[model samples]
Target: MKVNRFQVNVILGIANGIISALQTLWFIPYIKSFLGNEAYGYVSVINGLVNTLMIISVSVGVMSTRFIVVNLEQGNKKKASHYYSTEFFSLLIIGLLISILGIILSFNLRKVMNISSGYYNDVQILFLMTLFSFLIQLISAPFSASFYVKNSLFITYLIFICDYLSRIMMTIFLFSNGEKVIWSSALATDLVYLGMILIYYIYTRKNLPELILSKSLFKIKYLWDVMRSGLWVGISYAGNVMLSSLTTYFSNIFCGVIITGIYSAIMQLNIIENTVLSVLISSILPKMFKLYSNDDNQSLYNYVIDSMILTTLFIGLISSGIVVYGSDFMSLWMGKEFVKYRLLIVLTVIYLPFTLPSQVINQVFTVKNKVAIPAIATLLFGMLNVFLIIIFTKWLNLGIYGIAISAVIVQVLRDNIFYPLYLKNIINRVKWKLSIPFLIGVVYMALGISICFLVKKVIVPNTILSFSLSVIVSGILLFLLALTLYRKKEHLGG
Candidate 1:
């Protein structure tokens, strides 16, 4: 795999991801001071709904990327170019409709959530941002994929960095002047994102040869082909978004806004752990796509196995630390009062080891155009999330931990069920299982937790330092266990 535009894209991607993560980290103080916990909860719920719609817009782009990649692989630059333009125009139509629908749905979003108090205006403002954000996302997607085909990751990242920086500057500038600014900041961020996207659209138009809008570009045959390939991907993506983000709304409804705000901070920190791990794993897609494009099954197979092992190990150690010392991290990051919600933070921390595999496997099916299997998986996972959340939250009176627990439960189910099924669907030649290595991963988690308890016993004379030390010890043990269990053997390379 030649390092080209795609590698640049990956770098830019990591940069953008880092900036976004840092900006999110910085949001903690703003969240605590600008409004009540309910206000943070209010923003969370609106953000989730916006994400749900954003996922819907994303389905088209995700499919377009897959479709365009195949055309490029078959050496059909003409078809590939046409597909990009056609998809862009199609998204424009859908973008307009989505903006209208989102605007109309804004009132309903607030009504259904039944939010009251100083947040009503904030919620209204959030819905408007959703409308604009959705449009930007949909319109920019195809151009984003043009870079993907050529493997131009850096510029792809620059697009996001520019957008994110604008968002950050707005938030900082507003907050510095002592404004009530969460909603306003979000609005500014989305508008900046819109501007960055338009730049990409214009750039792609000028730079990419053979890109032109034509009546033939919109032919039914091409449209059918793209949709057929992407049919399952679109559905599952929608379900996954709902499942992943719906917890915010649930947290708000069941746990109170303040709790939601704290949970948001914890969740952000948890994602930071994953983001640090993401630095290692983020290169898989472009490289894997190139391997697959060249029909290099051997390298693809090796890359897949190695990726699973690396992701599992990296996330395992970090998750162990979070599950143990997250209270201290939260105390240090947010405040002491927020430490009461330690269980919520630990719940998110415990699950990432298992969760990262499902993410890897999703990319597998995506590149292969076998979207249906994963879509079904997401459906089952979403249903699982809802059912468990309902049973635990309402029937068992579980509170905030219910949402966290439900997430882990659904992730475990998705990893076990959908992964192998998608492998068979995509190639019909690969054999896979969940037997030994995965079980060892489970044991690794158990040991980390068990050791954490023992360390707690020894350090019990001093609670804070004890938990902190236990977390550190868990990290060391995980590193050794990972070395012993997850052997690096140049596994699965094309």
Candidate 2:
């Protein structure tokens, strides 16, 4: 039983995701406990602003991966190098400019964010450290792109695990010594980014030697080419950031800092689920891109359908657990105070089945270089999400729940309705009947939620150990059920 690259990548990715989630689990509570919820809230708002500004670098990174992989698949190493070099130099310039912008923003953070007079200087320091970390990541994006080119996400995940560990260790060291400031987290993050960038650079130079940085290889035309393909990716990423990060800013504005802190804490569960999902999906993307580039539409279609089912099942399992055990887990992890926000946790993730499976389809748009429409839809819906949040929170006085509800509505509209139809239109050669899998996904979610709730009723898990046991039992039962359903489908198809 020899393991393949994909299997290795998936295993490493899962491990990395778990580590990252644990880091979040520890980091969030530590910050809230030592620095207070207001400090944690300020840190979250600052980090959100940085993420919102990272759209350009993320777009460049994505396009660099796509272009590099596609060109390498075509046996054009020179073209791939050109794309890499162009992006590398471009990001350097972008990083410098953004650093300056971050400085200005840091000085005037009061105007943009709802910061208190007492914590203004501390928040500014946190903002600067976070901005510096982002700058490091921005410049290193091209180097990291090599892993995707080689389908070597195992290496990437390994590095990420190390980074997470370092952050945890640094935070513990800083906080234990009575340096319990919000900026300590950002300082830890900066060190982690510095280490990660060095590792990425060394790995790319040694293993992926074909990707070279040279002034000669950097072309204006190549920059134009990458940007032409990447602009939509940037727009789509902007929408995603708004939906996630900008919501934190809105929370500060509408509900106040204390509530924003609590909302940010609850959203950590959402972050963990997404971190895992993104890692799993990223493991398969190189293969998907390869299939598309080779004109293997039938195989690509099959691959996509399988991915949709698997992604849906995974999210369903996680969502069901959240819906059932969220309060118990939150009580154990954060404190009984957080248990009151259990409904917010449910709202944060309840729409995954409707949206995430469609995300698999949405990737096809990127593969086919047909992202304008989807990107526009995402941006439009993101704006709608903000508008609805304001209306619900202010006018209707729905408060924090308003933000969650708005997200669910917008996601269902854009991802559920638009993405599948758009995918059907673009992948026209394959006559993809998405209804079967879509219906199957619905069934999976319904059963998962119902059975998990039944388990909760049958076995009360008050303590941590009891909760762990309950989760294990329920997870295994769901796994077995999913396996049976998948095998039956395969048999019928056969």
Candidate 3:
């Protein structure tokens, strides 16, 4: 049997997913055990901030992928090279500026995050290390874009898995050796990224020689073109950073570092959902770009529709498991103290209904180059979410659940309800049928909620053996349902 590109991507995605999940599972406990909860919270904050800085790289990367693939489709190797080289140098400059910013910010670590004076040095060291690691990734963004342009994510993911595994082992060694400084873990992470820079450089030279650097590739015109295309992408990323990082910052300032630690644990588990969706997005985006460029409107519509339904069903199933067994899983995985965060965990699932489907829609927006509206909306709503979090926590005394609720509300309104409507107008060929997935998501979530009760009756919630059986059974059933729906919808759409 010959595996298709989509199959290859999915396989790689799953591999990356498992590796990421395992790393999170292993390292969170290791950090908590060795470095303690306060340090864990600081680590989470640092990581969040680093990812926030990634806005610069991601903006350039999205444009690089778009321009490179589109230009290649036109058989314009020079244009692709121009896009690659321009973005590469641009990201280098961005990385340097951020590195300087990181150094300056490192000095103010104690005041910035309210670090206790005793642990001030540790936080500063970790912050600096994280900054360096982020800087490396920033510079490597354009090279990573080469893989995406070629639709060769499997190779990229393969390298990443190796990197992740190496980091895990190194961190474990450091922890066991009493080198419990959080900066050591960050250093281990940077080393992997440095290795990736080298690997991607060699690989791009071998396979995508056209994407290599040249003086002719460094055109001011192409640099401006990239910046123009990437402007909204950068805005969207800034909004996302605000939403996620501000949540951590809020928890730290309002609730305390311990709660931030707890919140981070919840988010780490929640990342499993994002991991799967990210794989799906990466797998489909190159195709999405191609379909749009070819003016294959109907195929693009069907593709978006099918993907929306499939992502909804998949997320609904996982959300079901989380709804039914999240508390138990958290208790077992994190610690018994986490059982109290059950409601917050459940609230996070609300995002799945809106977020998962929107992941597919985002690709459509990107392909159409109409990302400005959605990006601006995200910024506005993200700020709204932050404001709501403040009001609910400080004024209404609602706490972290307030923050989670605000996020879900804003996402549903903006990304879910608003963005799809916007896409219908932009794509012009899309119809009201696109709304079907929303209805499906609602039903799925309801069923998932109902299953929580049915599950409790069938299997003891906290029992390891019983919970495992429930997940397996639910997963199989959900997978079958998703397959049936996908095939049925695809045939009907065709």
Candidate 4:
């Protein structure tokens, strides 16, 4: 039997979430114990710096997906194939160039960032590790974009499993041998990612008929289109990297590395949450591209409304659950020291829903060929985030918590205000069809909060049992409420 979209999304989401939870939340304790807090902070900060550089070298993969999906929707298979082929080669070339450039520039990096002399070696190795990771990722994306269009989420999950499983094994090995933990960790896991990329390419060559190109994909038209589309994409990545990846460099100079570690843990949670949401939304966008291409306005409208409603319900439920239990669970995973500030985690729990609206809104734009909205929103958010961090960090005396709060505020502005405004501007309207999603989200959120409180009061201590029970009970209650509401609406000729 063919898997439905919901089944595919749920399976892949759960699979990846399990690995992420183990790798991120679980590994924190392991790394903190082995490397000590200061060392862990150093590794994480360097990792963040590397990610900032990577946003420049890579990140056009999303724009690649949008372009490829559009061509596929227009039934232009050969052009789509050529596009992916070009993307694969272009990204490899860029990755090699960036890696070489970074190595050459490493000598000046310490002075450029003004880090203490003691931390220079650590920063250099971290930069090299990050560069390698980017190369692996750049190669994976062209093949991975095929999976996105085909809804091969299981393949995506397999990629993540390879990554996290390597992390776990290496954590054990590095801890045992007293090796340089950061470099060992990076070497082990990045090799795993590259191996997975090789596997994905093999599969794509055999399985995906749409990706097979015979002649060189060096035609000027294809090169021009990819470059033009990817220029905006590069700018968008620059903005996102400014907001996120560059934070550690800024924090180290202006704030401190210990606090950056605390912030890093929060970011790990954010990544896991957003990754799940992206998997949920990804399936719909590809399908919606077809509807939009055919000029099926009604179907497009319904898809938009339903996607927002579902995302709101899903993310709101998660946020409430996290708010109630996140601190307790993380306290167990890491330590009380790391968990000292309940307020940051609590603020993060509150912030998840506010930050979630953009996923759907941005997808709406992607399917409709309006990529400029996200680029514009991300650019503005980037500038505003820098200003807020500087203001909150040095002046407010609020410390790390202030940074977290400022980050959340910027996301809320981007997700809740800026994204919708972009959508309305581009689409030139916001129907009740749009507002109904907002209202449905409100209802689900209210119900979810109530359920979260009840679960907190009644939940027991066994991890496996508690997780299973929560999933089951939440499913039943949500299903009944949705069924009743749908029936009532149908009675009124909805």
Candidate 5:
């Protein structure tokens, strides 16, 4: 059987995610060896700052993809080109403004984050370099959307892999040649983004010739049209950043750079897991947009439910493995010191089943252009998360664990309860019993964790080889168990 474009996209996306994740995992130890853990903490904060600032750019990119895909699907090439041009020019202006803001913020980073005097100057320079890279990325966001418009997501993933590889090689080369500074990593990133932007522009011009970059195509009306949707999207992105990335900043404020570095290290696993899962889900967005455009509500509903199940299943399986074997893996990878923070790893990932499936619902809101309430809800809950983190850390003295706990509580409230109920209102034609899928996800995760824990007790994998074998065995068993449970549920429904 020949695989279709969707299958190809999923496969390539997973490959890209895996490669990118491995590169990150490797860089953690490598960077720690050279920059030391304290510098690593500062680097994490700088990255978080840059990512937080990029919310507008990401929102514009998202809305551009949605509008371009919808119009292209409807055979309105001119409308699509208008959106493309508007997104490009709008980001160009926004990117410059944000770059200035980022520079000013870079000066004050020492005040907010507990950066030591020794690394402050180097960290400031690194922040500036990273900010410049973000400017390039912001401007190139529209060019990247062309891949989505053409349903060639694999090309995007391929470019991402290439970018990651080049960054790795450049960082290695720089460090080997007696340039083992944190700013060097930022320089590598800067060069890679510059190269990737050229690739994106060339691809868009060659393949999506209709989307020409002309001053005439840039319309204020189109920009307003995008912002009508993109504003809420940007709010949602801000909320998400507050929930996830700001944890590093908070960790620094409450616990100091050493503890912050440890927390950031553990959170990397969670980040990689979420990125991989999101990549898989994103492979379906063009299809989702097409389905919604066609007014195939039933098919759209089916697609949503199917994506939720698959996403939940993958999260369950992967999270269970992490909860069970994470300590051992970290011990082997990062040394024996990390074994003590196994609880942090568990706290980082346990809420995934409750939260991540809601990403599918988020995409639904985007396609339907009904994001106002959800965006507000997300922003409010995100603020609540910040408040709770402060209370838990400062008043209650829970330290970094308090940050993790705050995330869990807020995510369950927003993603599990609020998002589903709100989605019900938007897609009101069908009685969406959203709880069942969440319930099933909880059950699957609980079962997998229990079984894997038991298996771990029996097989104590000390060496890397034994750990690898155990992971393989347990993974297969869990997959089989999940398959059985899913089939049984299908049979009962049938």
Candidate 6:
């Protein structure tokens, strides 16, 4: 009855995929029907603003997974407890700082986002709700991280499903009857995180007693160490958020909130691509930590390569399918108004194939604790992306497509060109190991592009039917190709 890491990850991945797809299908179209694009745009703006505020908490969670697994693997129970205790207090303080900032921002948010006076109170309540939600997540970072250390992703996914289901149902009910969509959605989300905290607390008390904090919880050295280790990751996390947040903010300031809503919807569709890559990389991450801790470089190298190739191929298949049918698909999913942004979808997906592989490689950096390089790289490139988004959208008048163009250019430079060179210098025998995956990716992408071209030429009439066929067909073909190739070159998975 017990599940291995891969099995759990696949189950979680499929479960999340279904949930996310349903969410995208139900929430956006239903809300847009009544709430209108402008209201949805404001919602997106608030979400981005709050996400930018949560960067430090995200960094702490990432570091918690690393340190918790490291200390636990070493059989140092006290050290593991210290790691948990350190991040626990540190994030609580950060959450307090966020609360003060959130309060101030709530007053200025209407003017800053250029909202009308009618929705001011609604926006304020949503902002405050998001702030509370984020604060709870911050304090509960260690408990959540403990779940990942135990490979309890199924629990995470279960909570995520419940969260989305509740949020979607509430959104439908409220939006249908002319209630505030923003408030309902934000409240549902905050409630889910609170529920996650409660469940994790119960689980820890029952099964993970050693994770409880002790008298050493306030040790200055331990707190300093966790902060020091997580600093670059925090910067890196902030940098990553800056990339997308800057786009949304710049688009809102220059192009208007309507465009922001449309762009956000396009990005939500692309999240399906991200979910696949995330599932694969996250599935192998705990194992990577253990392998690196044992100094099993060969196994670790193999894992990184196989995961990158698999992710690259699968993302390529899905993204390429999107490139072929996204215009009709979005129009059918949302409304005919969304069809105009097909080029935006194309440009957004161009980065998926490349970004997914880079994420896998970034996991290598995290496990080796060589995070500074990628962290610095992400910050520098993020700034570059922001600069380019401003230039293209503001000056050149490229409109919404400008944001997508800027993101792809920066992603190619950072992930494809720079990261490989950085990894070669540090890890031994990585170049040869990376070569196979790299070559395979090149071949698979070429085939994917050709398949996309063929599929695009097909004269399908009904948008929904066409979209369904494209996904089902492409998925089957991609899986079979992977199975055939893996069988022929077994060493690829070694």
| 10 residues in a row with least lDDT, candidate 5 | 485-494
What's the lDDT for all of these models? 0.69, 0.83, 0.78, 0.69, 0.83, 0.77
Residue 418 of model 2 has an lDDT of 87
What TM-score would every model get versus the actual structure? 0.85, 0.96, 0.95, 0.87, 0.96, 0.94
Cα RMSD for candidates in order: 4.0, 1.8, 2.0, 3.5, 1.8, 2.2
Q: Select the stronger candidate by lDDT from 5 and 6.
A: 5
| Candidate 5 TM-score versus the reference | 0.96
- For model 2, what is the alpha-carbon lDDT of residue 187? 80
lDDT at 270 for candidate 5?
A: 90
Query: Candidate 5 on 1-494: residue-level lDDT in tens?
Result: 99988888889888888888788788888988877777677778888888889888877878887888788788898998899889888998898889789878988986677878778888889889989988988888888666666778898788778877876887789889998777776787788788889988999999878776887999989988889888998899889888888889999988888998888878877977797677867787878988988989878987887777777877788889999998888888777999989899999998897689888988899998887888889889889999999999999999999999999999999988898888888787435445656877888988899888777777778888878878887899889977876676564331
Better of 2 and 3 by TM-score: 2
* lDDT digits (tens) for residues 95-139 of candidate 1: 888787787887676555757766677678777876677677778
What TM-score does candidate 2 reach?
Answer: 0.96
After superposition, which runs of candidate 3 have C-alpha atoms over 4 Å from their true positions? 490-494
Q: Which ten residues in a row have the lowest lDDT in candidate 2?
A: 485-494
Candidate 1 vs candidate 5: the TM-score winner is: 5
Candidate 1 global CA lDDT score: 0.69
lDDT of 3 by residue, 1-494 (tens): 99988889889888998898888788878788876777778888887767777787777778777887778766788888888888888888888888888888888776667576667898888888888877876777767766666778898788778867987888878877877776666777778888888988887788777776866678899988877868888888888877766678778887887888888888876788888888888888878877877888889988888788877877777887787778888898888988888889988876686567777987887787777888888788778888898898899988878888887887778767778788877878767678777777777777766766575677675667777887777677666666666566644442
**After superposing candidate 5, which stretches have Cα over 4 Å from the reference?**
430-433, 486-489, 492-494
